[model samples]
Each structure stands twice: as C-alpha cells, then as structure tokens.
Target: MSTYFAILTQVGEAKLANAIALGQTLKLKKMGVGDGNGALPIPDRLQKALVHEVRRADLNQLAIDPANASQIIVEQVLPEDVGGWWLREIGIYDEAGDLCAVANCPPSYKPLMVEGSGRTQVVRVVLIVASTAAIELKIDPSVVLATRQYADDKAAGAVMAHEAKANPHPQYLSKIDGEAKIAAAIAALVDSSPETLNTLAELAEALGRDPHFATTIADALALKAPLDSPTFTGTPNAPTIPHGDNSARVVNARALAEATQGRAGVQGLSGANHGASPANKFTVSALAVTMRNPATGQAITKYATGALTADVAVVGANGRDQAAVIAGTASVHLHFIFNPATGVTALLWSASADAPTLPAGFSFFAYATTIRYQGANVI
Candidate 1:
C-alpha cells in the first residue's frame, strides 16, 4: 500500500453527507499545496487545512478515477507559481473555501528560477467519496492554468470534432470538399472559353487593366451616329438615279452635273444653254383651249379646225412657219420661238388675232386657237 492517500476532513464529510441527502452537488473549487513545516506528514479527518499552505490555485481539472469508481480525482497545475517550499501536503477546497480533503505527498523542494533551478509542477488529490454524483465536475477555465499536454489534447479533440462528418462548422469548408469544388470551378471557367482568355489573369490582361473599360466603351459608342437616318459630313458620295427614269430616286451631284451638261443621246437643257437644241417639231391636229376674254370678261372655250380632228400635215419646211386653221372664225395664233444660244423659249401672240410672225434668228413652231359665240358664258 502507498503512503500517498487522501481523506475527507470533518467539515467536508458533513457537507458531502448533506449534499447527498439534499440531492445537490458539492462544487470543488480549488486545490492547495503545503510544506507541512518542511516535513512529510500524514492526513487526518480532523484537519481543516494543511499544516502550512504554500500555494493555492483554482482546480485545473476534475474527473473520476477510472480504476477506482469511488475515487474523485482533483488536479491543479502549478505553472510558474510559488516556489522555495517543500510540497509535503495537498488540500482540496470547496466553493466555500473550506478544506474538503487532505493528503500527504512525497516531499519535493520547488526552487525559483533565480535559484538556477525551476520546474512546473502538477498536484493531484484523490478522495474516496460515498457518491461522486453529489460532486461537481465542471470547472471555470478562466481561473485555472492548463498543462501543455492538456492543451494539446484539447486542441486535437477540437480538430477531430470539426472534422466530424456528421456536423461541421457552417462557415468552414473541408479540405476534400473544398478541393473538389475548386477543381469544378476551374473546369467551368474554361469549358467553352477561348484559350487566350481561359484564366482570370489572361482575361484581365486582355481587358488592359482599365477599371472603367465598360464605361469607356459605352461613352465611345455614344459619340457615333445611329444607323437609322444617320447624318453624314464632308461631301459624301452615293449612287445616283439613272437618267430618263423619273421615279423618286436620289441624285448625286455628279448625276445633276451630267444631266444639266448633257450626256450621250441626251439634251443638256441648262441655264447656260451651251448645248444643241432639240430638233423634234411640235405638231397639233386640233386645239381645245379655255380663256377669259379681256374685253367681255367672260369665260370662253375655243376649238380650232371646226371640231374636226385632222391628221397632222407639214405646212412648211421644218414645220416652223405658220400653222393651218379653218378659214372663217376669229382665231388666236401663237408662235413658240426657241433661242438655242440662251436656252430660252418665248411665246409671241398675234396682236390682231392673226397668224403670229416669228422673231428673227429664232427657231419657231405655231398652234391656233379659235373663238365661237355661245349664248351662256362657258369656262
């Protein structure tokens, strides 16, 4: 049997018995060490405290002894704590600061670092209690120091818990899962993209590192003319409408110039009149004209050739002299004379209602309008 053993003090026994009877927990709070006056000692149930306490600290850990079901294990880590005393006695204190258990230890001299010898110490006390169910197991982590081995064990346990397949941290991704998603994302990035822009860096470089590239493009497009009804500038040229086909088609400046100055098989009737005049003669078989007589101020309809529509006949050479008419009615004669040098046409009416005389050096053609008496005014 080992001389190292712990026993409940008188006050602790009463408290434990009362806690068990009341179904309450006896919360063990701290563990203390003593020197026993520099001598090894034995524990007693009558003792309320150690012979001489050297250090006291909140309990670091509390657990039931696995090998002894009735034994409650209380532990304290004296991490860089008090020194220069002999650890010959140990004590367990409850929440009320009452000594709950006392035990004797193999005497060990703890030295300060200034003495050139120092070491961290772990102290434990095992109490054989009637019912550990009435003993508190939870501890306040803030009041106690942990051993390196304890910290490492706790860290390993936490990692294993985080890696548990059942439930994981909501914000974290597992390594295997994260790798799969990353690979899938990479595959999608280049699934149908061009080889030059397959990667993020390549795409960024292609866009020239301009943060406002899209806005710049939009602004540039705004400066361009729209396709519909675009306004052009600076002497724009276009295909012109063909001559003699007088449908509504746009004519370019070149087409206008060609028409006015004459092209092959076409007459140039321009304001300058520098081209040849047309040689086709004017012919009329019968003339029907409406006029208001200036003397009577009445509307009159005139018919020439006595309402006979006759086939045209050339009365003179080149048909440019006098027009043929019926012999007896009051008639109006007109000569349409063209001046080829000036591109102008002048109409000369006979002042006596007779055949008009053509002006000198002017090519001419003639047509006649006649007058008859109708009782009602006809327009």
Candidate 2:
C-alpha cells in the first residue's frame, strides 16, 4: 500500500516486459521470421508458429530474469494473493507440479499467494513471521507468565548482597567490657618497680598532691607546678636603684658631706655683715619740724635750719626758723624718722631743748643725700 512499494512493483513489471520483448525478437530471428532473404512470410501458418515461438521465448526469458519471472508469477498466477504482509520467498510451478522458478522476494513484496495449485499453476509463498515487538497482543488472565515486575528487582537483590558483604553488623562492646578496658589502662600506669614507685611518691610529695587521673596518657604526663608554691633556691638579689644623671653618687651621709666641701650651709645668707660697721652711717640734709598752738591745741608750722646756707621751711605748714647753736656752736646732727600710720617723716633736733610738737594725723617726708668723709661714710 506504500507509494515506494507501488513504484518498485511498476519498475519490476517494466523490466519484465522489456526482457520478454527482447526474448521474442531473438526467437523470431532464429525461426527465420524477421531474418532477411528467404525469411518466413506473414501467412496464417507462419503467424501461428511465430505466436507459439514467442510464448516459448517468453518462458525462457522469464528463467533468465528472475525479476520478470516474479512479476509474471505475481500478476498472472498470484494476482489475488499479492499483497498484505512481507514475503520471504516465492516458488513458481508448472501444471505438472514441477518447480519452474524460484525468486527471493523483494522487501516490498507481500505474502498473499496460496500454497498448492488448484485450477491455476502453483506459486508457493513464504511469509515473514510477524513480530510481537511492535504488536500489543492481549493475554488471557488464566495464563501465568514469568517476567520481571519491577525493573530493579534483580539488580536490587544483587546490590543488597554486595552491601551485606561489604559492611557486616558491628559487634558492640558491653559496659563491663568498656570498664575492663579502662581498668587495664589504669593498671598500666602504676609502675611495678619499687624505685620508680618511690620516685613517683617523691614527685607527688614535691608537688604537694598526687597527679590527677586523666583520660589520656599525654594528659597524665603533663604535670604542672602548683600556684604560689614553687620553692626558690638561694636569696634573690636586690634590684639596683637607678640614680639620675645629676644626682650625687655617694652612698652614705658622711661621704656626701665630705664630697661637698665649701658648699653654703643652710638657714643663713652668705657674704653678709650682720651688724653696723664702724663708719658713720648718717647724713645731714634739710631739717623741718611741726609745731602746735598751745592755746588751741591745733597744729602750727615749725621751721628749722637747712645745711650750711639756707633755712628750712615747714612742709605742708607756713613758718621758718634759723639754725640752733648750742653754747656758741651750731648743732649739726639731724635725725629722720618715718611714721607709716600717719604717712610722715620727721626731722628731729638732737640737742634742742624744746621738742617740736605735731598735729594729729599729720605726716612728713625728708629728702637727703649720703655724706662721705675722709675717715668714714654716713648713711
């Protein structure tokens, strides 16, 4: 029914027809039908003989060309049985039951021929068995079939077996077994030799305690000294006190004092005179005094003599007085004093019989220069 099969059938039929024509032509020439010069004339006898020869030539050509022979067999003898399923082989037979031709069927040929001959000549057809791979056949429920239900069923069994071989169940240790292992480990730690045990006891005493039982041997071996309990040998040397660069290096008080000879002593000033010198330490200048009115008891101006040439005037008051001579000689001694309470300076007559009186709250200031003599100086 495919177009490709139809085209192949057409090509086989055309080749068969061409072969039959060629065979008939050769047969006619051999029978002297178409040969030049004294060939058989086209009469009824020649025509009948030519037709018989052509039929015989076609049969002979069919044997020579299997494609033609198969075509003829399919068309004339097996026309009713030439389609449906694929044909493997085809056998053409004469009416006498002798095999005339055998042809391997083309892939496009269908198996539709009946086996034995009836009225027509026989053509045996061998059909290719239909494959159930492409066909879904219904199975009866009563029939039992053996097949893998799940794809991994067989593979899963093998995988489980391999896993069992690779990892068997572990034998677990009991609590008593674990305790026995720990006891054996502890027993291994205690030294059997008496000297070693004595040394261990001394070490324990030196540490002030026995070593703690540790889970690991390394932990047991790692002994640490107790805090604040280490015994140091010999006395530790005292730290040296660092002295500043400018500090004295003498270690004792007497050494320091000896090192510092001629230094100034404490609590007193050096290179100073404590008392007045033998020289006259006073000078003469203008002299003025303050007087008071005896009747009113109020202050009045009192004047005194100045040095050698002038008379002194009373300061902040109005009066003047000449020099005072004692028994024919002028008195030259003058005494000056300052009163901070009244803010005043007073010039006093050293030999005067009458003392100058001053008003309450009055002050004075004297201006003088230092007097130098050949034998001494006066300030």
Give TM per candidate.
0.43, 0.12
> How does candidate 2 score on lDDT?
0.30
Runs in model 1 lying further than 4 Å from the true structure: 137-140, 167-379
Clashes of each: 0, 4
The residue-by-residue lDDT of candidate 1 on 249-276, one tens digit each, is 6688656644554332201111111122
Residue 88, candidate 1: alpha-carbon lDDT: 92
Displacement of residue 185 (Cα, Å) in model 2 is 0.7
Whole-model Cα lDDT of every candidate shown, in order: 0.64, 0.30
